[model samples]
Target: MKGRTIILDHLNGREAAALMLDGQLEDLLIACDAPAPGTIYRAVADRPVKGQGGMFLKTPDGNAFLRQIKGMAPGDELLVQVTGYADEGKAIPVTHRVLFKSRYVIVTPNAPGINVSRSIRDEDRREEILAVVHDTIDTVPHGIILRSSCAAADDKDIADDLISMLALADQVLNDDGKGPETLVEGDEPHLLAWRDWVEPAEVVTDEGSFETHGVLDAIDALSSPRVELSGGAFAYVEPTRALVAVDVNTGNDTSMSAGTKANFAVAKALPRALRLRGLGGQIVLDLAPMPKKDRRGFESALKAALRADSIETTFVGWTPLGHAELQRKRARLPLTELLN
Candidate 1:
């Protein structure tokens, strides 16, 4: 994903359009416009019609801005410049826009679907939450869920985000301001909220040294599931060429039949390989071709082994070449790829 910076004059639609068209902004950041706060929008530029270009802005706040003009319009034209490469280092255009002064607020039910008639003061905070919510709701509805952030938030956080927005809005609102206006900006990319939510069993990384500070502080606070530091595990990568080979070693497990043990080993190794290698596409599994007496035992053992990983594996019977075929879900990267 590419990052961007934008400036807008007040809540002028024309200025927004110019920045979007010129910068070819893919994502937009609006500073103000509370009441449906933190709303992020996507700008779709219509194909040039007879030398005239137009743009349509779709925001979660149920607001849209459209512009139809052949060239630039007057009065502080939206100025947007972007730096990002796409598809073989080609410049892909993106649209960015900001609204000055207007902040947003979102009124979510205390308990989803349970709307209560409650009023919250702290105008400063209310406006801020509204603005950010309005911008974020469109793109990341699932991401920014209404948590304690709104509960007794006293609008403190709201005020903070709002005040921050106002500072940016004020800068753009100023007529004497020299540089391009920046209506809104996103925070640093880190899973602060995720850390606050899910308590992982443990967080192991290869970064070395285990001093929990800064972003990792929240991870340290988790109880029940304590976080531990350890050197990263080894990762295995898949072969790039079309043809690849996997040699299965039985090692030593005398407790189970040879065929059953072999099947279990293969099943146990599949998930690790899939994840580490970032492997996609089809995967073919060749189990040790065992005698007829062990055939049923092998199939049963394979099924049992797959259950441990919560992955579905089909026997597909046996092939003429004595190989077993199975299908697994395709993940962006396989475990083996990452491990390698």
Candidate 2:
């Protein structure tokens, strides 16, 4: 895997981080941490809106939604975690299920269970990693999940990371006396994603850009509508209101052998393109059709490529018309919103 670069843009009231791989935007994240992910805040429950099907919880940021409502009352004070970003004219999504993370693991306070990353395909390796996690940490009361990165980590590294996470978990659970609407600012959401998710090689900020990396210049050059791969192959990615559509065209490459090579290049490029743009949802890939046998090989390569991604993805197989169907769990704001 090639190392990526991180570019941080801070202006006025907004902050954003763009992960660049080979000068192309691999993963872009917006810092909307007023009530960020992993942040625990005290909120007062308000009356449930029968029309909306959720209760209003008043926190420091504002009133957020409690979808299930539980047994919360109008004056009840509760500790909640911001799960998802606020929708347009809607409350920030909050959940009682809070989880703490280290580089290789995620510890869930309320839910006590062992779960592994779905991206980890090798069942044997998954079992091996889970065994390590179970054997290393036995006293933790919270649920522990081994991240995909744990497969590459050794026993000592996992143990050290677990100890640190346990301490943080204890701290989060013991804190008291904070007023309502007060935000328990944990990690900078982007920094957590950079460290645990993307794991970029070099990070360049607006202030750091002038030093040597030419990160700003790279971002400028790579900002284009179409991505041109070697052998004159290209992927035209367009985002729609519902899902993103990517078309692979072998421009001016007439040889049959070259076309086959182009399709493989497109296979490699498709996952990278999707990751770079942060386009998730039902992804349709329209490519030059290959034989049924070849399609299986291509699908395997595609899945392997997607394993690098932090988000959850399900490859729904190819349609009769040869369009590849995929569903990726939305990880962040769309590319348009992030760029804007």
Candidate 3:
């Protein structure tokens, strides 16, 4: 596997660590701005729990000391220290070397009956928003998802996400407050990353006409050509009670030899099957077995068939039962799963 660096700036250390653990970032080497190896820093937890979260510092006895302190709130800034790592053969130990100690600007609402004067100044709006935030924290337990708009956000965007979250909380309160439904659906970053990484050449759909879906739209936006729809050539065959079989037939043409034609057709259609339906798991390609002289040609054709799909495939020669054995990459869901 190849390695790459993903720089997540302006994020405190814990946020960066969480992202690394989630496999969103690979080969993470955390570094701090300070020159020293054990310099301490701190940042507010995006999702903080009372009496639960803190950085671990090493004691004089060579044991870890879990430093427990409180002050940080969501979106509050903190400094973080990058500690050294201990190696135990293949296993590497991470040691925390610093602490984050700072008081956050408390944004909480005043008493309900208190009459507060309104102001038109920008600073006034900031204070007002902070007040709403404080009220929201007290009334509803919710976390914030800092948006990219936050970089140059001029109060409006931040207010919008906050307001949206509040409205969702109110809706939950009104409808007997069913157990934890999604209040807001954030963009799925993985799909976007996958799209950016794997530039698919063509997208084919079984449905004759193309409809706009976010995934399909993203593919189209990358200028991938649309594979025109053709009549279904894929079929399911129940050859035995233990296993189900999928057969690709040359349905339209019957003039050529069954063995040669079948081999050619299977070779041609395998990639389409892999991509269109995203087939994976152990796939047994049952090509029509040809004479001894045709074996080499068939193998060559099968190899050529798989080249366009962008998936690593292994040709496992032939099974004892005479079916051609092939293995494609694993996918989350396949056409067979959908059909069943």
Candidate 4:
């Protein structure tokens, strides 16, 4: 209960996973009926939008929109992977580039190279991992990327994962089928949690572990928009159809720097808030009324926080009405939508 723990269980008849750190829920993943991101499909090009430089494809799971056209013509067949979830009535967002990812290795069919994660700054570790890669992989038809989890991983285990992913990539790429079909399905919630949450943590798989470990309570709290931040400050993360709106409120201490301090707290907690709620896309922050000079500090704190996050988010600078704007990747479906 004190250290990190990974809990796998069912929520609302759907498989769910939760990551807890120091007795606090840090991340959550829940399965849904929609087409999960990373699903590979051999689709037939339906038609290209005249001026949008994008094309829609016919897949088993309804229409999928893939941006970036490269002389693509109708009736042509190509392999595409679902990139992220789409809004209601919108085409599933997909990309031409497909990546085969596993716990330790990611195979890139388009890019060819054996690369190590930049986080492994130790030269010796890099050399050792590279040695493993070179030894495990003889012929490189696809690029191999060693994830950060490989830093302290066993040599034999890393090699095994690399081999397995390489074989999978080859099998998917070499499919000679002519009709549109699904090549591979996306990883489920529990499997995805295992792949990404590789940090040392206690594993909880017993029945009713979610209730025993307070995971259900934590998820219930997420139903509310109010997120209590440090120093008694709070923030509301409400997602509308168009965008996510965040409003920060100062803590109980009404000091001269109360607004600035509350704003800093919001900045630090914002990423985790959005992450647990699975909220993304356009985000606008109406931070507490701090002095204009303090805006730079808030931005710096938010940028640093987001940099530490794994999700792809871009801080698009402040707005004219003294608000902050951000563009985040739609990597997962909204938690509320899935739960409901």
Q: Estimate each model's TM-score.
A: 0.31, 0.69, 0.33, 0.98
Query: Which 10 residues in a row give candidate 3 its minimum summed lDDT?
Result: 99-108
Ranking by lDDT: 4, 2, 3, 1
User: Candidate 3: where is the Cα deviation over 4 Å?
Assistant: 1-244, 250-256, 335-340
Local accuracy of candidate 2 as per-residue lDDT tens digits, 104-214 = 878888888888888788998888887776787676578888787876677678777877887777776776654465545645645665556534377666654422444
Which parts of model 2 are misplaced by more than 4 Å?
1-35, 41-59, 62-80, 86-95, 111-138, 145-164, 171-183, 197-206, 210-212, 257-263, 317-322
Clashing pairs in 2: 25-276, 26-276, 60-181
Among these predictions, the greatest TM-score belongs to 4
Whole-model Cα lDDT of every candidate shown, in order: 0.34, 0.70, 0.38, 0.92
lDDT of 3 by residue, 138-244 (tens): 54333333322233334554455566544544443344322212222221222222222222222222232122212223223323222221232333432222232
Q: Tens digit of lDDT per residue, candidate 1, span 1-340?
A: 1222122222222111001122222212222222121222332332333443643322322223334444533332342212111122222322343332221222221223311113445566455555555553343211122333353444555445444544554444343433223333322112211212122222222232122212122212321111111121121223334422343434443443554455555655555344323343445554544566776766676676655432344445666876665554432222222222
lDDT of 1 at 153: 44
Q: Count the backbone clashes (under 3 Å) in each candidate.
A: 61, 3, 7, 0
RMSD of each: 17.4, 5.2, 21.8, 1.0
Our tally of clashes for model 3 stands at 7
Residue runs of model 1 more than 4 Å from their true location after superposition: 1-240, 251-256, 293-297, 300-317, 334-340
